[model samples]
Target chain A: MQQSNVYIVTFSVILTVVLGLLLSGTSQVLGPIQKKAVELDTKKQILGAVLEASELSKMSGEEVFAYYDKRISSKVVNIKGEEVEKDEDGIAIIPENVDIGRNYKRKPEDRLYPVFMFLAENGEDVESFIIPVYGAGLWDAIWGYVALETDLTTIKGVTFAHASETPGLGARITDASVQARFQGKRIFDESGELQSVNMQKGEGRDYSDDAHKVDGLSGATITAVGVNNMLKAYMSHYSAYIQKRRSGESGGMAVLN
Target chain B: MSTETAQVTEVKKPAEALLSKRRKKLLSDPLVDDNPITIQVLGICSALAVTTQLQPTFVMALSVIFVMVFANLTISLLRNTIPSRVRIIVQLAVIASLVTLVNEVLKAFAYDMYKELSVFVGLIITNCIVMGRLEAYALGNKPYDSVLDGFGSALGYAWIILAVAFFRELWGSGSVFGVPVFDQISGLFGDDFSLATNGLMVSPVGAFIILGLIIWVQRTKTGYVEH
Candidate 1:
C-alpha cells in the first residue's frame, strides 16, 4: 500500500499525541510518590551523618521519620550566618525545602543554606549540627553531610555519596571506613580560626595527632582534593554562626530547640 | 453465510491457538539454542554491567521482560499504520514511554534498587534487543506471535544474566542474595577455614570473562558454530 505525505503526517501526529498523553499522565500520577521518595532519602542521609551506627541500622522507615520529627530541627541561614525568617514576599521559609544544588548556582550571599540541629534524647540541648556539602568529583557531582559536635568545631561524623565516580577508587568515599576517618577532626584551630579539614595525600601517613587533617583515599587523589575543597567552601559559610556561638552570644539560634 | 463461517472459526478450540507447536517454538527457542545474548550477541552492555549482584540483576531482568513484551505487542499492532519513513521514530516513542513508566514505578515501590540501577533503567531504551526484535519480528508478525517472541528473548537474556550474577556474587563477595555463605561455612569449619574473595570477580572484567565462558559452553552444547 502506498503511504502518501498526508497519511504519514497524520499518522505521526496522532502517534506523538497519544504517547505524550500517556507519559504525562503517568508522571502526574507518580509525581507525589517520587517526591516522597526523594524527601525520605534526604532524611536518611542526614540521619546517617549524625545517628549512632547501631541505632541507625536497627530503625525502620517509620522510626526514622519519627526520630526526625522528634529530634531534628532545621533553619535557613544566609552566608553571614543570620537566620532567614522570610523571603522578599514575607512568606516563611522552610530550610528543609532549600535545595543545595539549585542554591549553589546563586551568589553566596543570596544562597539559602540549611542547617539541621540534632537534639539530645530529652530534646532540650543541641547534640550536633549537620551541614550539607556538595561539589564536583572526578567525573560528576559528589555530595554529603558533615555533623559537628555542640562546640561546632569538632567533627562527629560524615557521609559521602557520588553520581558517577570510579567504582573502586573515588566511589569508595561512601564506604564507612573512609567516613570514619573524619571523626575527632577539628575544623577550627587553637586561635579559633576556621581551618576546615584537609585530605592529606600519601599512604600510611598518621593523621592521629593532626586535628585538621584526615588520610585521603588510596588511588583517588583528585576526588580527595574535591572533597577537601567542598568541606572548606561549605564550612566557611557557617563560620560566623560558629564564632557567635563560641563567644556565648547565641541570640540567633533557632528557638525550636 | 460468511458471518456464520467466521463465528465457527472463532468458536474453535482456543487452547490450540494459544499454544500451537509454532507458538511453542517461538516461546522456547531463545531459552537456549536461539538465545538473544549468546547466539545473537544482542544487548551485551547491560548483561555485563548489571550482573555483579543477583538482586539488581534480577530486578533488571524483570524490567526488561516487561518492557520487551509490551513494546513488541504495541509495535506489532501498529505496524501496518506506521509509515516506513518514520517507523523507527514511532518505535522509539513506544519503547521510551514504557521505560519511563517502569522507572517511575520502580522509584515508587523499590526506591533503593531503583537508585542502584539508576541510569541503566533509562538505558533500556537503547538496549538493542528490544529494538531489534521489534524491527525484525514484530513488524512482520501477528501481535500474539510477537508477544511470544518477546517473552522468549527476555527469558534468554534473563537466564544468562542471572547465571553471570550468581557466579559473580558468590566468588566476589562470598555471598548469594546478600547472605554470607562463606562466612557461615567458615563459622562451621572453625576460624582457620577462610575463603578470600576474588576482587577481580566483582569488577566489570569479571562479568566479561564469565559471560564469554557461558557463551562458549552454551554454543558447544547446542552444537552451534559461527560461519
Candidate 2:
C-alpha cells in the first residue's frame, strides 16, 4: 500500500503521541511503587551490612522500613570529620539522599560522606557505623556498605552490589557468604595507620591472621583490585572521622557504654 | 525462514479460523524447527548474559515473552498505517515502550528479579527476535496469528536460555535455582566427598559453549545445514 506524504506525516505524529502518552501513563502509575521498592532495597542493603542476611530476608517491606526507622540514625559528614547539615543546594543532607556514585566522582575533600549508625536496643549507644563505598567493577559500577565496629577499626560486616559484574565471579561480591569473610577483619594496622581491608587476588586461602587482607574471588582480579582501591580510598577519606572518634575527640564518645 | 514469511504473506483469508492449521504451525514452528536461538540465531546476546542463573533466566524469559506478544500485536494492528519509510523507527518505538512497561512492572513487583536482571531487561528492546518478528511475521500477518508467532518465537528463546541456565547453574554453582542439588548428593556420601563446581560454566564463555553445543545437537537432529 502506497501512502501520500500527508498521510505518512500524520501517521507518524499520531503514533508518536500515542506511544508517548502510553509510556508516560505507565510511568506515572508505577512511579510510586517503584520508588518505594528502591527505597526498601537501599534500606535492606544498609541493614544487610549490619544485620544478618537471613534476618533481613525474613522481614516484609514495611517491617524492614519500620526496623530501619526504629534502629537507624544517620548523619552526613565532610572530609574534615565535620558534620554537613546541608548540601550545596541548601537542601538538608540525609543518608538516604546522599548518592555515593555521584559523590565518588567529585574530589575526595569535596565529597559528603553519610554515616548510618546502627543503634543498640537501648537506642542510646551506637553499635556499628555503616559507610557507603563506591567504585568501578570489572564491567560496570560496584558499590556497598561497610559496617565498622565501635572501635572504628574492625569490620562488623559488609554487603556489596554491582551493576554488571560477571556472575559467579566478580559478582560474588554480592554474596552474603563472601561478605561474611570481612567479619572481624581490622582496617587499621598496629601502628594506627589506616590500611583499609584488602581483597587479595585468588580465593580460598586463609586470611584469618591477616589484619588488612581478605581472600578475593578467583577469576575476578580486576573487580578485586577495584574493591581494594575503593576500600583504601574511602577509608582514608573517612579516616578523619575514624581518627577523631578513636581519639575521643567527638562528643558522642562521652555517651559510649 | 523466507519460506515461512512467504507462507504468511500468501494467506489473505479474512475469516480464517483463529487456530487454523497455518496459525498452529506459526505457534509450533519456532519451538524446535525454526527456533529463534538455535535455528534462526537472532537473540544470542541475552541468551548468554542471563543464563548463568536459573531464577534470573526464568524471569528474563517471561519478560521477553510478554514484550514479544504485545509488540507483535500492536505492530500488526498498525502495520498498514505505518509508513514504510519510517517503519523501523515505529517498530522500535512499539518495542521500546513494551520493554519499558515490563521493566516498570518488574521493578514494582519483583524487585529482586529486577535487580538481578538489571540492564538485561532494558536490552530487550534491542533483542533481534522481537524486531525480526515485527518486521517479518507481524507486518504481513493478521494480529492473532502474529501474536501466536511472537509467543512461539519467545517460547523458543525462553527454553534455550532456560536450558542453558539449568546446566550452567548445576555445574557452575552446584545448585538449581539456588538449591544445592550437587551439595546434597555429595553429602549422601562421606564427608570426604565434595563437588567442586566448574567456574567456567558461570561465565559468558560458558554460555557460548553451552549454546554452541545446543545448536550443534539441534541441527544434527533436525538435519539442518547452512549452504
Candidate that would win on lDDT: 2
Report the CAPRI category for model 1: acceptable
**DockQ numbers for every candidate?**
0.38, 0.52
lDDT of 2 at B64: 95
Runs of candidate 1 with Cα error greater than 4 angstroms are A87-91, A202-209, A249-257, B1-17, B172-174, B180-199
lDDT value, residue B157 of candidate 1 = 90
Give each prediction's root-mean-square deviation over alpha carbons. 4.5, 3.0
Question: Model 1: how far is B72 from its true place, Å?
Answer: 1.2
Q: Write the per-residue lDDT of candidate 2 for residues A1-257, one digit (tens) a residue.
A: 45679977998899889889998998899999999998998899899999898898999999999999989999888999988998788988777878889988889999989999999988768899999999999899999999999889899999988998887788889888889889999989889988888888788899998888899889899999999888888899999988877777355558433
Chain B superposition TM-score per model:
0.92, 0.94
Each model's interface RMSD (Å)? Answer: 5.3, 4.5
Q: Write the per-residue lDDT of candidate 1 for residues B1-227, one digit (tens) a residue.
A: 11111222234354567788989999899999889999999889998888878999999999999999999999878876778777888889999999999999999878888898999999989999999999888877768889999998998999999999999989887889979898998899898889877878878999999999998998788899988
Model 2 earns a TM-score of 0.93
DockQ of 2: 0.52
On DockQ, the leading prediction is 2
iRMS value of model 2?
4.5
